[model samples]
Target: MTPPKLRRLATAGLIAALLAGPMQAAAAQEPLVDHTPGQADIEGGATAQQDTNSLDASLSDAEKTADSVLTVDQMAANQRALASEIGPDGSSLGQGIERLATTGDPQVAPVDADAPTGTAAVSYWRPSGVYGVDVSSHQETVDWRAARNQGSQFAYVKATEATGYINPFFSPQYGGSEAAGMLRGAYHFAIPNVSTGAQQANYFINNGGGWVNDGKTLPPLLDVEYNPYPSLGNSCYNMSAAQMVSWIRDFSNTVVTRTGRLPMIYTTTDWWNTCTGYSTAFADHPLHIANYNNSGAGTLPAGWTGYELWQYTSIGPVVGDWNQWPSTLSALQAFARNNTAPAPSAGSAAITTLAGRTTKLGGATSGVVCGLIGGGCYQNYQRGSIHWTATTGAHATLGAIRTTWAGTGYEKGRLGYPTGPETCGLLGSGCYQNFQRGTIHWTTATGAHATLGAIRTAWAAHGYEKGRLGYPTGAETCGLVGGGCYQNFQRGTIHWTSTTGAHATLGGIRNTWAGTGYENGRLGYPTGPEICGITDGGCYQDYQRGAIHWTTATGAHATLGAIRRAWAGTGYETGSLGFPAGPETCTLVGGGCYQSFQRGAIHWTTATGAHATTGAIRRAWAGTGYENGRLGYPTGPQTCGLVDGGCYQNYQRGAIHWTTATGAHATLGAIRSTWAGTGYERGRLGYPTGPETCANNRCTQTFQGGTLTWTPTTGTRITYK
Candidate 1:
């Protein structure tokens, strides 16, 4: 007949931490635990009895105080004050009594041993990559071999468009994909302008080889995107929720019966969520989601733990043009198997600058424009195409645009605007708009005609848009729905490779055939030749001292300083293992012992401790430094750090001379990261606040103000230095 009790038992340690105030909530909530007492309340009641005793004592005091109170309200106020001292958090005296009722005590209730235990579970998921191809005339040769060679694992070959029409690009690419050993499937970009689902299915079935070899390929996919054409059929873009579902179901079932694989659905994140009410319906089906980002920057569906695959990074360069391509094959397989899903792979991390870190701008201003072949300039808009409706925010400039000259007649060079896609090439042969936006336009004139510069569409994070090539690179490029290279071409000389390092070599010309790792240069020609075997080498080392020099194949040389230098002790003979007696002997003995080096320099301990010639040590250390700073071991020097409120090299300043600890005045440098992370200082000091002094390499004051606080040249200091 007793009311059910809910007693919460908390440990003394837990109580202490609880009173410490809120930090951060755990990642997930704990599961409910059962809390039912099975045994009689002997031990449990003991703690409750103590709380009851305390409550009684307090109540008795309140009663005695009330009995002597001058008025009822005054007595009540006193009672409230007394109750507050003994209450937990904001619990009122009445609330305490109510809570204590279940435990038969007024203090904290004993934790229930039978209460359900709370625990966390992890998500069981994996990611799969999906490869999508938008075939048109360019991919007629669909080389399955090339696709496989490039690591393509699955193919969603274009089948039809919205006019109940088949894309002319599909057959050859499909046949090529088949020939090249790629796992293939067909998809119809739903044509709302055409017939009903049954009619569309019939057209697809008849045109798509009768769906006879279903097992040979993946199930047919539905490529649903924005279908703006309203004339053929209004059904393409607008449909009731029920009608849309029914239509999809019908098309899917038809494909399933014919292909022997379950039909899949491919769509943009927005379309899937808004147009068809598919957010809930498609959860159980294989969905190929598209969110165009250089990395996964697009919105995604909620509760969409797994997807058949994802479309990421579409700006892949191949065959003289950019084609969208999947960043990985594993992501496709995982999606197909219903194991896991991935966001787009068009990674856009924060770019660290001397000014501090910043989020990437949404368009062309965010990318590094590149040059292309056949006498044209290429601009790689970090994202995708520039959507320049007059309403679109645009900054423009007057410039030459290549129409039909020099092959594709597009222009070359960095543009003065930032409106177009990541990459655009221009030719100067025909009439064209002579204006540029969203890029820096650079043009070159040759005799009768000039190469004009044009803006390309922005390169959205992971998405891509194909551009027509008057002259093709002969090789085809493919992308995930959002990832790929937009082919830009003007015929010159062609080589069959995806060497993003350099432009495609033209006609075996030595200048065109750059080698790999050297930023794709013409074959047999030295572009950025790296000399690694030299002493104290810079990325372009050219001289040899404490430093080394690099001579460009183009006949340019650059000098670089030695990364580090160490002196051998006096009394040591050149290349011999002994010490000198005096300073003069120290100079003489260590004359040849000046150890010039770079980071990661090493000397064999087995070798006798002798003063090797400084020249010899310099030579050995040349072009061998791999670390950023001196990480020398064996007795060269300790790590460099701040001393005397300044960065001291090689732990240069001794304890007395160096007044501050290593980290006291030194700062970590900014880093290029996609997410927030720790940074380091590359032997540079933060700006100074005021005049600071040091003598004999020692801090004059207990603190040096100059390097202590980073001050702004501006009147007021900014948020971050």
Candidate 2:
């Protein structure tokens, strides 16, 4: 029989895309097609003889690319790569590796009218081995139970092809078979000329070719057969035997280096011999040969003394390419677990970081595993664990600090990664570690704590350990009133509400706040930092409900509700009425409340609301029993700019008028009204000159313009001064 069955029909449209060379390879990749495999295969793997004349000029396209690495976006690009390399049968590329030993006109052996030439039925006597199947995207969803029912034991799913294309259906196909209790592995299809072998190997591993010590996951495989696209390039992908050998070695070595396992090489006999120059370098790697003869897998590749697996048929009895291992199920599993955890190498920095400290950390309980959120890695130990990232190096965390860190979601938490190791010798024997977010402090009394977010910033601004607030007493406690959070410290506490952010409270302000029940108090939480630039050496911190103004003379007190608003309107501590001197009290007749300030007091009632009374006018109102006597509460602010350089403040009943000569006085009853008939201060009576004198149940007052007298029987009579 002539060896080289002539090349024939291809999916012409698919092959035409290769004319643009590697650019097309790196361009938009096609996703895996979830469909049944097409019917076509030539014995030594040849194409069908139809459409031969039409592909004459197109078959000689020799596309090449620079061997430099690709600056690829692996995450987005790895989803798909349907290439010109896909064969007519879609799953079988071995046909392109068929031996080309023809001398006369190319000829194809005869087979069924519908089947591609050289297709033969399998012999009744099958090879004795653990059988399985290798599927690509074209197989879609394979019925693993059906395949396993056929006595198939394990499966290898195509993971990626070329540096550009990853089998999109990989997760379901690979995981589905495993979930069916079958040992599974991943494979990469090599397009060696497109990019360096190391790059493709990394892409494969990053996509799915990783290995765990689990017996259910098999070692990865490298499928390096013919180009499968003879129309695009030569059979060996436009490379000579020497270049092909170098490419195979690079791919094999990289896979070994990354996974710590020698990958199985799948190829056809004639292609392995012709393309690799029959190199013996990869004899250590298990070989999976592809042959489609009637009796058995035809011949061995040059390097491998014996074959480990076989892809026996493209027209699979079930869904995909049929595979068989010449060993039992247990032996196949044993190969998958070899050289599993190869991280933290003997001389590596991580190992050196833990050199003589195993006593403290205890023996390792887990391997150095990576692929962290920030590219960090960690190895667990009996007592503790060592965490490593490019920026943080390797550091061990254990005990309460580690427990607290774990409680915070580890590296994925608000603290992110640790920037430094735990440092002790702080006040009260406290220890702290700086992280991307903040710090976690631990002490014997406090146990362990984490200070984070705006709360941490407020603490740092105050002086941290040496400030009025010492080390944190506990982790930041959240979910308080109004979605607020607070953290207690050795000396005081810092509070954070969504609307207020964070602020520190210490000394008398804290005392009064604690007395009022802290966050649940009338003041709620502090909305801003304290300011001491007041009239006196006083400071004040504003809170949600009110404020606490502190001064050496008046101490600290909160003025809340309407009373506080009245004080704020009066220019706060810098105004006529100074800082608050006492907590607001509601013990008044008629359910009225009042807050005493440095200079005066502000009173509020259900009927009159809140108003401030200060200076000489306030004393005059106090003499009249304040809100209990004639004038109930001041209705307005103290008004100046009256006649004769005078000032007057209105009240619930009457007004208290003050001036340099008149001092301060109040007007009341009928005799005071008769003075108002003459326009009082602005009219003939002008300003009051003397207090109203009373005797024998009668009262009288002398003003600058006149004197008004009153009796029990008669009202008032005005006598001109």
Candidate 3:
């Protein structure tokens, strides 16, 4: 009888041939293995199992004869007879044999390189040799204990690949290897083209590459090889040999820096030589050489005098890449121990003490240290930094305070160095950090803020910390309108224009300025800060357009644009029109604009420039519907020092005059012509005491000097004094 393995192989071959039919004839001639370079390198080489059934006593007479010369029809008949052997209950005796025949063997065949072939009978661990296996997700479920029992001393389980992929099988394999008393390590499959080498290395170390100084754990390995991504084009990842070398160096250095241990470099001889130009710069690091030809590692790659591990074959009893370590296990353990020794603590006593104080904040003496001002040191922490000096004990700077300090360049910045730790529970529920140059304050309402330079100097003069402005709410920001900068404080804001210098704006005056779009609107930037102690405990601020004036009686008002220029011509706030009582009201009567002041108001229209009307003169103009009335817009400003101690303002069609005795009245048309004829106010008619009264085609005005009348019958009649 044929052996069970050989019999199953024969039956499976027959079934495959019957399924293929005419295609089997063509397929039988082709080689079982494709010896393509990159393609064949993956999962070792291909070795086909031969199907031989020379000895078999169970064959029937007809089947025996047919096996020698089987046609498609005969094969079909045999398949039908075999199918009936599968009963409803389960696989029959014949069907069970067929199931075993189709399943085949699970062992992957080894590459047919010119190496000494070994079976399970051969001892994997020689007295002089150490052995391990490198595995990734492709290995699936592994009996790690069985592998350990087969003389495997160690295992390097793949942890991460590229930048984002993590091996799903890593946890089980790593834990099983360690549980089985085999030394275990983790490795990353390097994909330099996918991301920066440093970033990938950090991801690797953070995931599983980190190693404690345990003698049972091996140093991490970086699996750099031919590009597995052929679809991306180029076996060398489309990079030049020099670039590949730099990428490898960057990855190795980053791994070493992050985890206090140097990583072993794994590569095939040809891959290293071709992709990296056989660079020998990494001579000091350990090498893991892979060579399938198996002529004793087949000429080790450049830079590696001797390799720590050699992947001799892809097919092994452990179901992974088989590796052989030339050194003994103790030497390997020592190598792992030496590379992962803890780093030394910081040298400065102050920094060391600071580290102890800030342990919960992730501060450590082993962190990066830099010189601080006046003979001191500063150490960095995950959340913040600690500055130490003889004068000031080490203090942590974090949160908003740290951000403000960083904006000014930390210790080396304009703030120089921190003088004290942040102090809380200040006025307004705020916190502040003092620096050599200035201070940064923070509150829940305003976040962290900084103030310095000329702006800070001006704020300091106004009592600063104790002033109404209180703590700063924001940093000094520049590039404002008219090439200026401003800083916001709790109660007010300080602005500085090149021409105006530094000044503060507060209360109502500031609000009015803001209503005009601050410095960016028609008013432009503030020419000067708010100046108080004016006409009536009022305040005023000058701007490029005009000025904003505030008083308890008039509130705050902006006087700008055309009406403002007109107001300035009238001696501004110091004149008859004291401080602006109201903002300029535009689109008024007949498209006119007007602004109210302490004395009176200035009104302007397209038809008339701008003119002021005060007291009774303003009242008389209002009675005529102001600019919209028949008198039209004001032609000129109100004029006083008339014939008596009176005032009059000219209009398009009429004029309004005022006196102590005659109040104020408007005189126009024929009544005004008749009054002029009577020598106006200088003549018999002093100033019109009352406006022209008309009835039944007759009009008359009662003046101080005379009464002027007009009629259709009598052209003009004057009752002079």
Candidate 4:
């Protein structure tokens, strides 16, 4: 199908899905702001402040009852309200379709000297194996050993273009490939308007030829994206697909004649149709395609067997690995060979680790250090069990240190054992006293070692936590791996405010808090110098303040707990909610709604649903009914506080119209709820001016536009205004 056709289908699907869900309602228990009932007073101190505020005369629970549920008639009204906001000229659909269908340009290149000499073997295409680089645009260095350990063998480095225009991102990737010791190749972006094929070839040959190793270099690739002709601003808009194909062909042929390497095409699917007509002009050559979703391949023009490489998705983090690309090294090598057949090499030796120490049975010994104090290293800086070692022989002892994860992550060492105490005798003072101080003594034949105060307390061990102090402290702390005292001095200690009930805290010089429940009904177990106390009190039970008034129950019918107004709460919200950094709007009590005013996203509370906007931008969109300065207001039969899709279901923006799936209608932004099962859920309003559906008890369920559909399960509700 054409791009336009596909977009139309997508748009329809999106619209259908939007209209079916029910609008949610406002929260019944809009938490009282800072109400401290019968707060106890300290002796001879100021009295505790009580919550005092006039009730909103125009706003009450009963006043909102009428606007809660949305009827089918209201749905139509919502559609009309949004009609003007969606599509060009208020049409039912936007721009008809996404794009038109067309032909892509044919590509030609010099026969690759590195191409396999044997006849190309036909093979079935299957999505198997990993394809990734040892280094990437983000990493400045690469570890060959680590790469090899992670199974990396193939690499792609960035190259240059002619006309003096270079890829803004280079240097690091170019050098990292060598550091990684992976088989390598390079590619140049087809810079439209500036560099012709010859220019690109000359630039690459001059700056990138060294990347090839005999026949090992992967085939050259051409990145062709946006059209580059400056004079064709809108010209390409009306140009036939055939024309686009011609331009690409001209560019392709120029580079091939100069480089003596087959140039593969790298482009998006839409660009393919506009320039290649999905024809066989370059059918024999490899094609690297970037289709974020796997669903679009079947729609490829006829005669296309399969892509040489496919970038199916982005942003995947595999365990024990690094790189933004989605595939692994072995898979990359296979993909380079087009998975026709396999060649063999013995796998690298296995690495053994104990107690957080590692050692390769046959790996070299030059990098090991022997004097490390701790047997295991942690990622954070805090003290742990320190173990010192000293070498005693010519063939020095070699071994690895293990971390909590049971891996040999780093190396350690120590000097040869003392030849004799007399050989190091002069190191001590001349005071020849030798007296025991407890179980140990600082003494020598020549003199007693410097007084106890002279010994420096350096960190000898580290643990899995971060930013721990030297020596044992009753406070919670952990150390980072590699024997650091603390991860960084900056993230020292994170303190929180007082909280009611049994709130636990971590303690100990090692900062181990994984265990559950406090000892003796206290916050955490005391260790060394560390101790736990109530949030409002100082460390240890001694400094705890007497009971505060907020703890007293106000009775069964009365509401309790913190409630954010205007904006929602997120990330340790203790005081009034603050403004966000993005777009926002505000609302008045009864009417008046506007859109598109720059404003800092804000979180505010109102006595009677007053209109206000304050945040990033100076100006604010105007509206009402708990406007968080977002798009619209919340509407549903159930109390808005109901949690759905990981966010509170009741939050909504105020008075802004956008195209709803049902047609043009007011756009009611959905609120994310922390209580929702994994992610965020959508909510809407009941009343509007057009053909749209408001959320309600009858229809609040996520709909598939009458057909089954998938929505993001993980959503965020921690929005401000």
Candidate 2 lDDT by residue in tens digits, 1-721: 2134224335444334433344546533421111112221111211323222221212343222311122233212222233443533233334342222112112221233124322335532346777888887767778876886676668888888776677778898886776444678898888765666777788989999877665466787888875554443445554544456666667767888887778888887666665555556677888888876556777686556788887766555566467778877556756666733444432236744663555678876444545556677666666777777887777777788887887786787888777777788987788988778878988898788899889999999998887878888877888898898888998888989878889999998789888898889888889899888777888888888888888888888988888878888899888878888888899897898998888998988878889889898898888888989887777887888999988888888887888889888887778667877888689888888766789998899888877889987877888886
TM-score of each: 0.27, 0.54, 0.55, 0.29
In model 3, the worst 10-residue window by lDDT is 89-98
Candidate rank order under TM-score: 3, 2, 4, 1
Candidate 1 wrong stretches, greater than 4 Å: 1-134, 143-146, 209-216, 230-236, 319-721
Error of 4 at 299 (Å): 3.1
As a TM-score, model 3 comes out at: 0.55
Cα lDDT, model 3, residue 190: 70
lDDT of 3 by residue, 1-721 (tens): 1212212223444433333455445543432122212312211112212224311222234333322223334334433533343122211001111122233211112243212332212433232478888776766688876786677878888888665667777788887776444678998877555455677788888878877665566888888764433222133443444455666667777877877778888876555654555566677788887654335766776667898887765556765467888877666656667534423334256666666766555834223233334655555465776776666566678887887777666665677667777888976688988887888888888888877877888888777757867778788889986789999987888988878788777888788878989878777777776788876687888887777888898898988777888788878778878878778888787788888888888888878888888777888788888777878888998888986687888899988888898898888887888777767788756777778888999888787777777899998888877
lDDT of 4 by residue, 1-721 (tens): 2232111112333333322344322222221111211212111112212112201112223222222223333334333433333222111000111111111111111144112111112231124443444222323344544554454444555465333444343555554443333445666644332323454556665666332212235666666543322121111211223333444455456555765446766665554443333334555566666543334333442234776555433322221112222345444445444443443211111111221342222333111212123222111111211122222111111211112111211222111121111111222321111111100112223111111110111111222112242222222122322211111111122222222211222232112222212222222322222332423222321112111111111100100121112332231112222222222233533342322211222332332231223321122123332344444433321112322211111234423222233221232333212212222223232222232233432112122122111234532222121
What is the overall TM-score of model 1 with all chains considered together? Answer: 0.27
Q: What is the lDDT of residue 540 in candidate 2?
A: 85
Candidates in order have lDDT scores of 0.32, 0.69, 0.66, 0.30
Q: Which of the numbered candidates is closest to the native, going by highest lDDT? A: 2
